[model samples]
Target chain A: MACFLVPTTEAIVTTIATKIIEKKEKEAVSTELEQGVELSSLHRERFSVKLNRLNHLLWGGSLLLAFEHFWHGEIQPFFPFLTAAGNPADWAEALHEMSTVGVGMAVLVTCVWGVHTWVLDRIAQREGMAQHEEQARRAIRK
Target chain B: MTLLITILAAVVTSCIWYSSARARRLKTGVLCSMFWGASLMWLVDAVAEYIELGAAYFTPAAQDMLNDAFLGFSVIVLALTVWVVLLFVKDPDGVVRSALHNQRS
Candidate 1:
């Protein structure tokens, strides 16, 4: 649950926030330049492309993890809580195991994905600032 | 049953990933994440069952197997519905906006 929810929440928040921030920045830059400079579509396009790539990486990584677990026989075929066992004791045991191991794995995966997104966001921010500085310098020179 | 669930989730996730990759968009990222999450959830469930059942895990009652299949299908449908809602809200391409404007005009 965490694996899915964490990334989905992060993506939605970041994507919307980034869009808002970009719009504000564009407006500010435009006012400052007084139409002397036009915002380059390239930077926006690059950001979009980079974000898409990151999404792909996250998806692919998760898929690979699932496959690896499956290969290791760590994943078998059984539904615990949903199925009633012949022995009530067995059902209780299954529930206990799931709550512990299942929850732990979900938390672990969510944290890893959160860290990945943070690192990627930082890189994108740094690159974006650098590009803006270069553009400013070029404008001054011109 | 858990294995089948995992496989089904994987297949859907892959399809979404492939389409998103071709379009070079992250619009379906949420959907992929949801399915992957569900897959992982089921994977852990499977492991626990195997641990409990040991060798007997391979042989499940026919009725129980059917119930599991129903549960798996329910999960897939739920995930798909959630994804569709997210996509509608996001409206990345502004199609919704365009349609609204056209209607008003």
Candidate 2:
């Protein structure tokens, strides 16, 4: 009840304040920039999309596992909305124990994935440098 | 469950088969065939679990056979990937030289 009341009060105040604060849109924005310049001509951040995907997948999987198996009972009564598997009271200890295992596993997997990425990046970079050198050699030969 | 499993297995096999078949002219077709054939055998085992058999001759045979087949093919694929990565690393300079020459020509 306190959580609900506090947030509601805050929201109402914030909404009224927002209405009092006048907001205006700019009519015209003029900016000039040179065209025909390659974006990659600047130093680009080389990011591995695979690693980002893997991080998202790991986070989402852990969140689902924690919610379904760990926080099943307690967080439900306050909201009175979430469906739980059963009384987590009996299994709360078990859930607490499993958290150690889950976090340990997540850390271990993250390390392994990091190692694999490091290997891949190092190999890719070495190969790329080798290619650049080869091209330079050919240019000199020409 | 049986039907769904069979369909999923079929899709996987089809993909492996397609990739294997589309390998360059120099590449052998044995790998693709072996992989898909073994997967089919496993699918048959899964199907057998749902099936009611009066005769006991081939009842337990499917799983045992498929298990051995999966083990064999997986080892072969593992060795193949190792060999390919090794090959790529081995003649790195020569490959790069040829690549640059081809690009220039």
Candidate 3:
């Protein structure tokens, strides 16, 4: 329910994706009569490159964050599984907390992702149809 | 700390996944995976800490909790910073590049 914390990232990513999809769809329809599959491949490749770049950034930043946390003494070398607790009750409580929070967050993220996919697909479909109509009109005028 | 961190990570991860799924671009997937990975890491940490602290884990001192919150916030900020940098580097829509070229012309 508290998903509005990062509106900037959402807005930037959305705008960029919309622009790329529109451009690629227009190009595919106008230039290639029967190479629809190739256009799909190209679209996939665009995403791959973007994802790869993000992955590099993610890894680099994560390592730095980890080191910082280590310095702060929040993270121990033994970490999640191997750290020693004082008793069974404390261990159980921690496990309970982790499962409840971790799993809850996972579910929430999945739901948001699902909604985003649905909405974007609808928008893309509508835009594609509009483009098709414009192309048909040009052909008739010629 | 673990709880807060996981929730925030999940939120960012979902946003990234949605962007990737809809645009069919890998643009945000890296961010998504990173957050999810971090969440997993914290999950392990929580489990380990619980095992160590047993019942006392439920009643952590105020200072420790505060520290965890700060660390969690820092992680989220760092992730966002990285994402922003990648956006500039890739300039997926070439908006940055075009703006520069236009200014030069």
lDDT of each: 0.57, 0.40, 0.56
Candidate 2 residues lying further than 4 Å off, grouped into runs, are A1-45, A56-91, B1-105
Per-residue lDDT tens digits for candidate 2, residues A15-81, read 4443443221111111112334444333222343434423432432232222322222433544434
Ranking by lDDT: 1, 3, 2
- The interface root-mean-square deviation of each model, in the order shown, is 9.0, 16.1, 6.8
Model 2, span B14-79: residue lDDT tens: 465566634423222232322332233333333444464645524556765565455444444443
Residue A36 deviation, candidate 3, in Å?
18
Best by TM-score: 1
* Model 1: residues with Cα > 4 Å off, grouped in runs: A1-99, A107-142, B19-26
Candidate 1 C-alpha lDDT tens digits along B17-105 = 78666432545666665556555555665676688899898899999888767666666666567666766787777778899999999
What's the lDDT of the predicted structure labeled candidate 2?
0.40
Q: Write the per-residue lDDT of candidate 3 for residues A1-142, one digit (tens) a residue.
A: 1111122233346457656776776676566656445554344334334333433333433453354446454346663522324456755654564465434433443344556556766787787789779999999999
Of candidates 2 and 1, the better by DockQ: 1
For candidate 3, write residues B49-84 as lDDT tens digits.
688789998898999888777777777777778777
What order do candidates take by TM-score, descending?
1, 3, 2
**Which pairs in model 2 have colliding backbones?**
none
